[model samples]
Structures are given as C-alpha cells and as structure tokens.
Target: MKVESAIAQRISRDALISILLYVAPIALMFTTFYLTGYKPWQGSNELPFKAPGFLEDVFRNLSSWGLAAIVLGVGVIEFAVGLYENKWTKNERTLDIVCFVVPKLVVKPFVAYFGLQLMPYLLPAAKNIFEWVPFWWAFLIIAVADDLTQYWYHRIHHQLPWLWRFHRTHHSAPYMGMAMAGRQNIIYTIFFSQTYLTVALTYLGLGYAALFVKVVKSLITTGAHSSIPWDKPFYEIKWLNPIGWVLERLISTPATHYAHHADTADDGIGNYKGNFGNMFFVWDLIFGTGIITRKYPTSFGIKHYQEEEWYAQFLWPVFKSKKEGSELAANGPMVGDAVPETETVTLKQETANVAVA
Candidate 1:
C-alpha cells in the first residue's frame, strides 16, 4: 500500500509538471505576440518573408517521396557502415522492414485522408484561420507544441503499465540504427498525436511552418537513433564542451537518446526509465525526466525480450505473441519483469568486449 501510494504521488507530480510544461510555451507565444503587436487572428495579408517557389516545391516533394528517400538513404548508409553490429537477424529485419514500410505506404495516408474528411465536420470554422502568422513564428510555435506534446505522449506510455505493450515494439530491437528508427506498432502510429496535431495545425494555416518543422524534427530524431554518436565530439573536444552542454540539453542527441534505450540502468550510463525526449531534450530537462552521460550503453533493448513475432509486436491485442511468457502473448502480464541487477551487471561485463569492438 505504501509503495502504491508513492507511485500515485509520483504520477500526480508528473502530471502537474506536464501540464505546466505544455502551457508555458503557448502562454509565452501569446505574450510575445501581444508585446510585439503581432496578431494572426486579427488578420493581415503580410508575412515576414516569402519562400522561393523552387524551395516550396522542394519542401512539398519532401513531404512525400522525398522523406522516404532520405530515410532509406540513411538506413543504407548505416548498413554499409555496419552500424547494426551483426545483430540484424532475420526476425529483426522482418520487423524493421515492415514497421518502416507500412507506416509510410499505408497507415499515414489512411489517417491523413480520413482526418481531412473528418476535420470539416469537427472544426468547420477553423480551416486556414491562422494563415496570417509569420513563417518564423509559426515554425517556433509548432516546433514547441508538437515536441512537448510528444514528450508527454512518450512519457505516459512508459509510466503506465497498460500502455507499455503499445510501445514495446520500439524498444525490442537489440541494436540501434536507422532501421529501428521507424520501427513501431501500427496502432501506436495510428494514434500518434504528433501526426494529428501537425495535421490540425496545418489545417489552421500553419502548413508552411509545419513542413519545415517536420523535416528538421525527423532529421534530429533519426540522427539521435543512429549508432554514429555524432554528438560525441561536442563532449570530447575541450573548447566544444561548452557547445555540447547546450546542445545535449537543447535537443535530443545520440548519447542522451541511447541511454533511454539501454537494456539496464545498473551501469548508471543506462536509463531506460527516463530520457523521453523526441526532438528536443529540453522537455525532459524541464520535467526532470532526463539523464545524460557522455558514454553509450554497452547493451540495449528490453532485458526480458522474448523475441516475439513481428505481427505480435506490431499488431498486439489483435494478434498475440506465441512465445509463452512474452509480454505480447495472450493473457501475458502488462509489463515484463526486469532482469535481476546481478544478472544484468554480469551480462554487461561479458558483452563489454563485443560492445567495444
């Protein structure tokens, strides 16, 4: 009972902090508009700047085939560089490929099409209403709102035992690379508030700003999942340490994000329980959900991973895992038991030689 009470209190505290985090930026946005005498609802034909026609065309293409091209390109590069460390087994490959392809080719388009049809009835008066806002301000507003909302979405999934299965697919991969970046359950993708949020913003005339934010956020998140450790130099180089300090806190970096995927937190470098930032690490810092160590975790994925089938991971509750004790199995527990601390430490020590190579 005391443990449950403590858990309840912690959740309440997190909820309060999340509400404040969500509101602060929006409040500041309005305040900035008021102080600067910039009002989108009041209506103006003027914008701060107009993007070039060719550039607009490029962004449009990026919204479709272009984005897929970029992801595929990066995945190929990661493979060529052996970033998966020979851990991409046949089952892993099937899961990763399906998760990557299905979302882009099937799920997203279905949502966008249905969402467009539904928005007219749901928000009849809101289409293109805020079109007058300047491009830069719109970009800033969308970036903050989208990322923060996603931070909460992600954090809650980890906190709530029932929702863990929905997110389990993302954490099942034993390796980190571009392949695992888009690897997620179909239901998780369908209910991804970020997609709907962006769509609603675009409907309200922030389409232009949404385009830029989507591109930038995608690159940042994908890079963070890569095994490249691009942010390492920032921590290593003496003069750049100052820049690293800001960069790690300001946005998600490979080092910070990898910790979130670490198989165990026993090493102090691994922190699967926190670091819920997506595009911006600032949200984690603000809500006290992040941890940063310059070192990468020696291992990753769930300590109790049962190698559930791809269909089970991607379509759970609809299709259950056949693996007897898997979390996705029928009548399985909401969350799996963690590997014992002693076992985890021993496993890490044994894997150390392979991890360093």
Candidate 2:
C-alpha cells in the first residue's frame, strides 16, 4: 500500500486507492452485469425512423454487459502491470488509479451519452452509411469513426496548451501501464463536442454504427494504453504489420502515444502533448506530427512536471493554479509556451530509455 520514494518526495501518494478505485467497481459491475445479465441501455436517436423493421432489428442490441467485463479485465491488467513494474521513481501506483478513473468514469461515458443522444438526429445519415455495407461493416465503421473522432480531439490536447493542461494529468504519471491510458482530465469529456465526422456519419444513417464505434473506442484506446504490448509481435507478421502500421499511423498507437509521454524530443517530444492520436496514428502522419519509436520510455511525465494539487488536477479549467510555472496558468490550452527548454535538465542515464530501436 505504501509507495517507497513517493512518500519521500510527496510527488505521489502511498495510498492504494487506484487499485481499489480502478478494480472494485469494475469487478462489481462485471459481476452484477454478467450474473444478472444486465446490459446498458444501448441506444438513443441514432437509428433512422424510416428503416425497414428488419434494419431496426439489425442494429438494435440489448443493453451490453460486455463492456463491464472488458473494462474489469483491463483494470486487472493495469493493476498487475503496476505491481510488476519496479522502475518507477515516483511510485505512481496511486496516480495510476487517478489517471484511469477520472477520465473513464467522468469523461468517456458522458461523451458516449452525447453521441448516443445525437443518434436520433443523425439517424437519417446513419441509415445511409450502411446502404452500401453489411452488418460486419457496421462494426468496422463504428470502430474507425469513433477512433477517428478521438484522433483529432486527442491531437488537439498536445498542440494546444489549454487542452494540454487537462491532458498533462494523464502524462504526469511517472510510470505507465495499460491503466495509464485512461489517466486524464475529466473535462476531456468536453472534447466529445459533436464533430462534423459524427454529424456527417449520423446523417448518413448508419445503424448502430454510432454505438459500435463507442464500443471500439473503449477497447482500442484501452489496448493501446495497456502494458500488454501484444501489438509488437502482431506487427511483426508482414500482413499484420501493414494492418497495424496502417491503423497505428491512421489511429493512435502506444508506440506513438508513449513517445508523447517521453521526456525528450531527441528521444521524441512526448510530454509536450503534441503527438495526440487515439485509435489512429495516420492522423499524426497526415498532419505532419508523427513519431514512430520502436522503443518505449524508461521514464514518463513532463521534464518539469508540475501540477498544483489533486483538486487542481481534477477540476483543472475551473481551478486556477495558485502556484507558478504550471503549464496552465501562464497562458491556457491554446498557448504553446508551457513547453520547456530541456538542455538545462538532463535525464539520468537510466531515465532515458531505448528510443526507436
């Protein structure tokens, strides 16, 4: 329950809260949903009212229990990753909980709800999106579209300072594993601000396309942030690599994302929050902000990684920093000034990990 050095520096807490916060609810939810056969109320206005009754049946799924199971499983993986990781100087076990819980609990669901409510208005386009594709296509479209939305919003976090202030909470974790992926500002829910892509697709009238994309976002983003690293081998297979490389470039991958958390641009400019993409790396490549590293960070977090307090970390945009030199107060999300010059600071030999090997 106690983090060794974290107690000394007071940078991270010894509280075992993340283990409980991240795990307990997921475990309970999974148990409750699976044993009780409970599913979330899975739809809203996204279905085209004019569709053949069969089409309605095609997309209308009972509320889902699968997400609870999946989220809990990932939560366990994150906990296990934290226990096994011996390298963290900041003792970020507790921080991991905050990172995972805040965004996943407060943000992702709200965004999903907004997207769902929008389904009604978008039902017309939602129907059209599927005119050419089959049911399975619905899955792919959902996955791609959801990630696509995340890709741009995530990218904005790094490019703009105000957004980065919220995002910095995610990056500030000194150690990362699968759980780290969820670490972020709750206000990130705001990024779900309706987009042209969603609107366009909604108008296209895709059945359950919106719903499917929501499911995929939770899974893919969770996987990319996980310590699993299964993608490396998958990427090695010539066929798989192309798919992964293509998707990774097209959507955010751990390779690109973890690099964004890296301390050095020479290694790669990670913490500046610039290399943002969720499900696709291609967004970065297309936008000219991509960095592909074969290696991961020995250390994580911004060089001068400073946040005022936990309250400040959570209610960020509203809670102005009482301290100085924070990335937020100096300007805001859009300002690029928070990024610091690194020559003055040097990484410990061990701190700088293998980059792009």
Q: TM-score for each prediction? A: 0.83, 0.58
The true-versus-predicted C-alpha distance at residue 157 of model 1, in Å, is 1.4
lDDT of 1 by residue, 1-357 (tens): 685587678778877876776677668778988898876666742335665776545335542343334334444554444335456878888898888767755666555555656777898998778887777767887888788778877887787678878898999899898778888888888888766765676667676677568779988998899878999999889999999999999999999999999998889998888999999998788777799888999898987888899899988889999998677888887653256455557888989978988
Off by over 4 Å in 1: 38-86, 340-357
lDDT of candidate 2?
A: 0.53
Full-model lDDT for every candidate: 0.77, 0.53
In model 1, pairs of residues that clash are: none
Q: Which is the leading candidate under lDDT?
A: 1
Please give the RMSD of candidate 2 to the true structure.
15.6
How close to the true structure is residue 346 of candidate 2, measured as C-alpha lDDT?
Answer: 41
RMSD of 1: 5.6
